[model samples]
Target: MGRSGLPPGEDIIILLVEDNQGDVRLLEEAFHDASIANTLYIVNDGDEALDFVKQRNEYADVARPDLILLDWKLPTLSGEEVLKEIKSNSSLEQIPVIVLTGSEAQTDIITSYNNQANAYVPKPVDPDEFIDVIRTLENFWLSVVRFPTHTDED
Candidate 1:
């Protein structure tokens, strides 16, 4: 079995809602070496993130993600707003959504939890540290937890 607890060939799907291109690349590199098997789908803006999760427009045929990593700073709609929408939706609420942002603001952390975020993680400044953080997140979220399974056909 893979680290996520699914049978050997199955892969966990993760949605990353981040606008920063540099952070996205770092995440890609980190996931490339992660111990668990995962398919990371990225949305560069908040609007696209919502659309992707809600399966709107171009995202209509995509598989629903088992986990989500959200960033606070984004273009168009903000992360708080996106988090609210996802949590309010019955179909999407079961998927774990973690707020992964650079801000260590008490307000941001509180707001994320208020909007029903499953967890909150601060971004590390150093590139190597950032990768290590991602690996740690993957280890706990992917290896330790048994992810939700969607019964609906994709």
Candidate 2:
């Protein structure tokens, strides 16, 4: 059971930070097909992602996500910046962040890891492959990892 008092693999929340509409739609479809009973929250830019995680402005009522799927390239803050902020903050650092990006560059991968991103996956061009990746990701992160119960604090 997690901090939420739910059994393992139940009621996990994920925050996806991606600006591309098409990619967002594809991820949504893929997550649905994966059949995981988890809530996915979407933020279109890095700035909004920060706000959501910080529980500020319009996001004060939302819960902290169990996982974060971040795109390295983003408007406003950039995923790298968001990752750094999350890792540096004591209240949010426990959540695992995965860098899901279109760039396969070695620099992007290294930078993401340096910033404490838990995993890096290049965005697959094929929809089917992307869905499979999501399924695998769900199986490992949600099923295998034991997350700390969330708390709201500085």
Candidate 3:
């Protein structure tokens, strides 16, 4: 068993779909001191993010994410489009997706929820607050809630 206590290859897995370098760096730094075992996979744009989640092309060997943290604004396909795609697909729909972005627009919030986002978190401007939020999110989503570790056999 690993540090998270499931199995050898099963550590808490997270996929972050973000384009901002600073935001990405901050998120990485926040997870550096995490208590549980985890692996964070990053995809800078929506297209690449979709490819990674679908396990297509270069992402064929990548582990499926237990949770996906997605930024609302992304290049190529927008986060809204990605969320719609993920939710519509049967194989991908079960993965909990949280919309983590700086935008707090009422429309964006409403749209995210309408499209079936598991949660929507507004990014704090202060780095310390951001880290604190990440830690709190990690504690709740990773430790408290149980995600499906095994994919159903096709």
Candidate 4:
């Protein structure tokens, strides 16, 4: 195991469903700076995100992600809709989903929780603070929590 004590057998897969290119860059840089040993997949819209999750078409050979970082305001299927679909699916329900959004509205938070989002974090405006948020997320998910092991058959 590395610093997180996660299983050393493979790198964790993290899927980020975000439409903002700037935010994607920030998240990428932060993960690299934090030295997280994982694979990051990016999807520009909610439709693509769902496609990736369902392993349809181009994503047929893609590995299922261990964690998902979702943004609320998205093009095509809204993030709330995505969350509901994931939570309702028996095959996908076990995976942890963290909402990293700019909206701090109470309604958004409550709706996310009601849909079974594992955690909800508002995006930090400051670049450094955003990095800190990513680091904290990495620490908690990779070190403090135990994730279900996923195999090809899963």
Question: How accurate locally, in lDDT, is each candidate?
Answer: 0.89, 0.87, 0.90, 0.88
Over the stretch 37-123, how does candidate 2's per-residue lDDT look in tens digits? 789999999999999999899999998888999999999998999999999998889889999999999999999999899999998
Superposition error at 89 for model 3 (Å): 0.5
Candidate 2's clash total is 0
RMSD of each: 1.6, 2.2, 2.0, 1.7
Q: Model 1 — TM-score against the truth?
A: 0.94
Tens-place lDDT digits, model 3, residues 83-126: 99999998899889999999999999999999999999999999
| Candidate 4 wrong stretches, greater than 4 Å | 1-7
Note the residue pairs that clash in candidate 2.
none
Per-model TM against the reference: 0.94, 0.91, 0.93, 0.93
> 58, model 2: CA deviation in Å?
0.3
Name the candidate that leads on TM-score: 1
Better of 1 and 3 by lDDT: 3
Query: Which digits, one per residue and each the tens of the lDDT, describe model 4 over residues 45-116?
Result: 889988899899899889898899999999998899999998999889988999999999999999999999
Q: Residue 102, candidate 4: how far off, in angstroms?
A: 0.3
lDDT of 1 by residue, 1-154 (tens): 4556566778899999998999999999988888777899999888999889988999998888989999998899999999999999988888899999999999999999998999999999999999989989988898899875567742
